[model samples]
Target: MSIKVIVADDQEIARTGLRMILDAQEGIEVIGEAGDGGRAVELAQRLRPDVCLFDIRMPRVDGIQATRSLAGPGVADPIAVVVITTFDLDEYVYAALQAGARGFLLKDAGPALLSQAVRAAAGGDALIAPSITARLLSAFAGAGRSAPPAQPVEALTGREEQILAAVARGRTNSEIAEEFHISLSTVKSHIASLMTKLGVRNRVEIAMWAYETNRVRT
Candidate 1:
């Protein structure tokens, strides 16, 4: 089945461009579009698309707030959100990430990457823009915090440690599998174990834990 998506941006031209790019891809479809954040939230709750593409700045409401409303920590049922923006600013990216967005992309990331990011979010993976990934995550790891990350109740095995580092460095599960000469299932097993031990929801949170503990430094 095609991955269903909702595009939310204040600009008609931007929404049109994104819809055109996504609609042209096989196995991907733009199911809806919203011109502002309030409508975006309403449509997302009603449609519950596979992925939501939101621009950061909008009238009446903003993308971050919309993201938070749909996928924030307090949400009972969180929808996957991929924040699309014209700006590459770290602060905006950080806020979006903290708001529980599954991925981030600059508007010019192009069709291939744009599609990849949508698929990644739908598949429970993350795809932050590489131009700002490391710097933004590293700084976010330490910013406005005075305490260390919660230590895992169970100790990390060597393999799990390796997986954590790889994820922290922005390596995908497929890449980690290849790097360790392990099967995809084994890689996922290690990732699952890591998530359980670290008490994280996904790879992004695992990466944050790694950075918070200085396992992967900038």
Candidate 2:
């Protein structure tokens, strides 16, 4: 089945380019386009697309607001959202991820990453721009960067700890499985456990928590 997507941006040209890029990808379709967050939310709630590709700055509502409406915590049956923006500023990246975005990509992330983000989001996986993954976290860590990260909720098994480190480094589940010589389902189980233990909603948050706690060092 095709992965349906909604593209939302304040600029018509940007929206058009994003739509074109997504439409050209195999198994991906841009089903709707919205110039503002209000319409973006309305179309999303009604159309129920597989993914939402949103720009951070919009007229009525920004991408973060729109994303929160569709996918934030406490939202039941949330839609998948991937934020694509020109700004790779720390605030925007953190805000979008905290708003429950499944992925974040720069406008210059190129067609390959754009399509990959859509596919990953549609498949219930999270992707942060590789170029920003490690640096984005460590750059903002401050003086606490050297401190060891505290374990969360409960003690993590040795395997879980390894999984957490792998995830913190932005490795996909398949990659983690390959690295650890485990099954894909096993990797997923460990990730799910990590999310529960860390009190996070997604892998992006998992990575953030690791960085914040100094678990994943520079």
Candidate 3:
């Protein structure tokens, strides 16, 4: 099935561009477009698309609030949201992730990453632009980069530790599997286990936990 998506941006040009890109992809479709965050939320709640693409700055509600309404921590029926913006600021990235965005991508990240982010979110996986991932975490990792991990390090098995370290470093599942000479399924299994143990909804949270607890060096 095609991954149904709602593209939300204040700029008509940007929305059109995203729709063009996603429509061209094999299994993705831009089902609706909203010019502001309020409409974005309304369309999302009504249409129930598989994924939502939001720009941080928007008239009326704004992307962060819109995301929070749809997928925030306390939301019982969260929809997957992928934030795409040109800002690239630390604050925006931090707020979007905290508001329960499933993925974050820069506006110029190109068609390939855009489509990949949509697919990943639709499949209940998370993807953040690698460029932002390291810098975003490292900026806050300094005060106590070596502090004790948020979760007991000993709680994880040896193999789980290895996988957690790789995840903290922003390695994709396929890359982790190739690096460790293991099957992709095994990598996913380890990640699932890590998420359960850490009580995070996605890899981004796992990465954050790893950094907060000093599981991986910045």
Clashes of each: 0, 1, 2
| Candidate 1 structure quality by residue, lDDT tens digits, 1-218 | 99999999999999999999999999999999999999999999999899999999999989999999998888998899999888666467667777888878889999998998898888877777666567677877766466777899799998899999888777767778899999988988998999899887777778778877888877
Q: Write the per-residue lDDT of candidate 2 for residues 1-218, one digit (tens) a residue.
A: 99999999989999899988888999999999999999999999999999999998888899999999999999999999998878666466677777888878889998998998888889888777777777776665433335644468898999998988888787777778899999999988998999899888898888888888778886
**Which regions of candidate 3 deviate over 4 angstroms?**
140-149
The TM-score of candidate 3 is: 0.88
Query: All candidates' lDDT scores?
Result: 0.86, 0.85, 0.84
lDDT of 3 by residue, 3-66 (tens): 9999999999999999999999999989999999999999999999999999999999899999
The TM-scores, one per candidate, come to 0.91, 0.91, 0.88
Residue 104 in candidate 1, Cα distance off native in Å: 1.1
Q: After superposition, how far is residue 208 of candidate 2 from its true place, in Å?
A: 0.9
State the TM-score for model 1: 0.91
Model 1 misplaced stretches (Cα beyond 4 Å): 144-146
